[model samples]
Target: MGTKFRSSCPISSALDILGDKWTLLIIRDIMFGKKSTFKDFSSSGEKIASGILANRLAKLETLGILHKGKLPDNRKTVIYSLTQKGIELLPIIVDMILWSDNNLGDHVDEKMRELAKKIRLDKEAFVNNYTGHLKSLMAAL
Candidate 1:
């Protein structure tokens, strides 16, 4: 799980872990898509490869961004949940979504555009409410 940082800068170091194309998508799936299992992630719209998904999941777990666990009824089934550190990424994710909505208007779907508008109305409240919900969900797990 040890990663070698390319530079000492915080942004560079953070990017060293998260810069991969699929990592944040995985996080997005867990956070907003209500996806937890390996099967769920593999079947995402992005269609991430199984091997790559496994690698990214492991990396996230190692980085303390995700917690790996087993489903209560099915011990063999693996579930991935966001850690507190991962929950902290909400603002960044929201900003990314807003940026896409604003700068890539036509490309964004109507549903997301609407959500972005709601988010724009009060970005802090949106992030805070979602963060609280996620933390409660994690606690329930």
Candidate 2:
């Protein structure tokens, strides 16, 4: 699935799908390194509860940003992954991280700040090279 077209304006359309704080943060988590399970997301310090996490996961799937599935041998575990539409938001996520690091002042790590700067400088190239891993991550969902 993909973003549902609401109006011709891109901003309006994007907000219709990802306007909420949790949705974007969930996408950020998955794209950055929270791919495996719900526990990983909560552990990131956002402290999202199980119920809200489940709802956000469902909502993201409905918005086409996420796809969910269970591991074959571990039915008890569910994996959440970003779709192509979701991966396309990488630059936006990177920009947010960079902005937070710059403005939040000491909340984020210095090494991570450096990495985010590198990422922001070459967003397109970084995304292009990560396509294969992105696909594999999606497949895990």
- Candidate 2 has what TM-score? 0.79
Weakest lDDT window of 10 consecutive positions for candidate 1: 108-117
Per-residue error (Å), model 2, residue 128: 1.4
Residue 70, model 1, lDDT: 90
Error of 2 at 87 (Å): 1.2
Q: Per-residue lDDT tens digits of candidate 2, residues 6-114?
A: 8989899888778866778788777666455788787766677788888888888887777787877999988888888888887777677778887988888776788
lDDT of 1 by residue, 34-91 (tens): 9999999999988999999999999899999999999888999999999999999989
List ranges where model 2 is wrong by over 4 Å: 1-8
Q: On a 0 to 100 scale, what is the lDDT of residue 116 in model 1? A: 91
lDDT, candidates in the order shown: 0.92, 0.77
Q: For every candidate structure, what is the RMSD over all alpha carbons to the true structure, in angstroms? A: 1.1, 2.9
**Alpha carbon RMSD to native, model 2:** 2.9
